[model samples]
Target chain A: TQTVSQSDAHVTVFEGDSVELRCNYSYGGSIYLSWYIQHHGHGLQFLLKYYSGNPVVQGVNGFEAEFSKSDSSFHLRKASVHWSDSAVYFCAVSARAGNYKYVFGAGTRLKVIA
Target chain B: AQTIHQWPVAEIKAVGSPLSLGCTIKGKSSPNLYWYWQATGGTLQQLFYSITVGQVESVVQLNLSASRPKDDQFILSTEKLLLSHSGFYLCAWTRTGEGTLYFGAGTRLSVL
Candidate 1:
């Protein structure tokens, strides 16, 4: 079974400040990792995904995430956050080979204060 | 451009009432459909998925069932609504080989 873990339940940052939301996964085989954002009262939107090649994948609205094989981690980062960036972020994982059942972490709620 | 739509944007119902939610995808053929539910302040949990017409697969058991009656339609239904059934229900779709999923606006269900 694949499992995803988002270590932080919430993170607060001021506008223009850098932020990193931690995520870690445990899987024995090839896996797909991705990040999604859900704004207040809205459904989830895909941010970015990593299956192969580049470890660092860029996403919409100036967000990026790096996948680490050794650490089994896929942490999302933003150089600078805007007030509009405040939302709930989720990290998901699935096995690349078979039974692509997506599993999500509890999510990390971001608060960007101006 | 493909579009996904969900019906009954918000619903309030008493316990033991029957509930049915619908989803439709347009401008796409043979798309993979999915149903996901999320509790307040919680992560999304995928309930069902369908790869083709009349072939719905349950990912998790929530005392609910899903059906794909047409190429573009998916329905979620339960004989009795429990308080635990109250949550946001979202419909999503992707191409046969695509990994990215597109989601609908979602239906907010409140079971009293």
Candidate 2:
């Protein structure tokens, strides 16, 4: 069974401030990690994904995430958040091989106040 | 590049009424399709998935059913919807040999 855990339910930051959202997963064997952002009343947009090679992956709109095997974690970060960046972020994981089913975290709602 | 589309951005249905939601995937063939439901401020739960035409796997049975009458198209339906069915429904698809899923705009359903 695959499961994802996102400890933080919410996070608040001021405009132009940096922020990081934490995510952890429980899965055996190799895995693929991904992050997605959902704006108000909009579809989810893929932010980034990590399969192998470099753990650090960059995504759209100045967002990036790092995959840490040692800690079983994949956390998303933004250099400077804009008010428009206020949205819900989700972390998901898939098996490295044939298992394509994705397990998603509960999500982290980020509020960027201007 | 692949794109997904869902219809009826919002809906208000009465109890015991039939409901139908549609989704289509473009720029990809024989992709894996999935339907998910998310209650307000709740975790996303996968309802069904299909890897090929005429074959769908249900992850959780929620008094609803799904169908893929054609490749690149998935439909979700409920004959008698209950108030518990009110929530956001999202449709997603992914190409073969890929793990990332592309999602639709999602339909917000309100069962009265």
lDDT of each: 0.93, 0.91
Interface RMSD of 2: 1.2
Q: Which CAPRI quality tier does the interface of model 2 achieve?
A: medium
Q: Tell me the tens digit of each residue's lDDT in model 1 across B21-86.
A: 999999999988999999999999999999889999999969999999999999999999999999
The candidate maximizing lDDT is 1
Per-residue lDDT of B68 in model 1 = 98
Screening candidate 2 with a backbone cut-off below 3 angstroms (N, C-alpha, C), the clashing residue pairs are: none
Deviation of model 1 at B31, angstroms: 1.0
- Residue-level lDDT of model 1, residues A1-114, one tens digit each, is 889999999999999999999999999888789899999889889999998999999999999999999999999999999999999999998776636378899999999999
* DockQ each: 0.71, 0.72
Model 2 C-alpha lDDT per residue in residues B1-112, reported as the tens digit of each score: 8778898889999999999999999898899999989889877888999999999999886999999999989999999999999999999998766678899999999999
Off by over 4 Å in 1: none
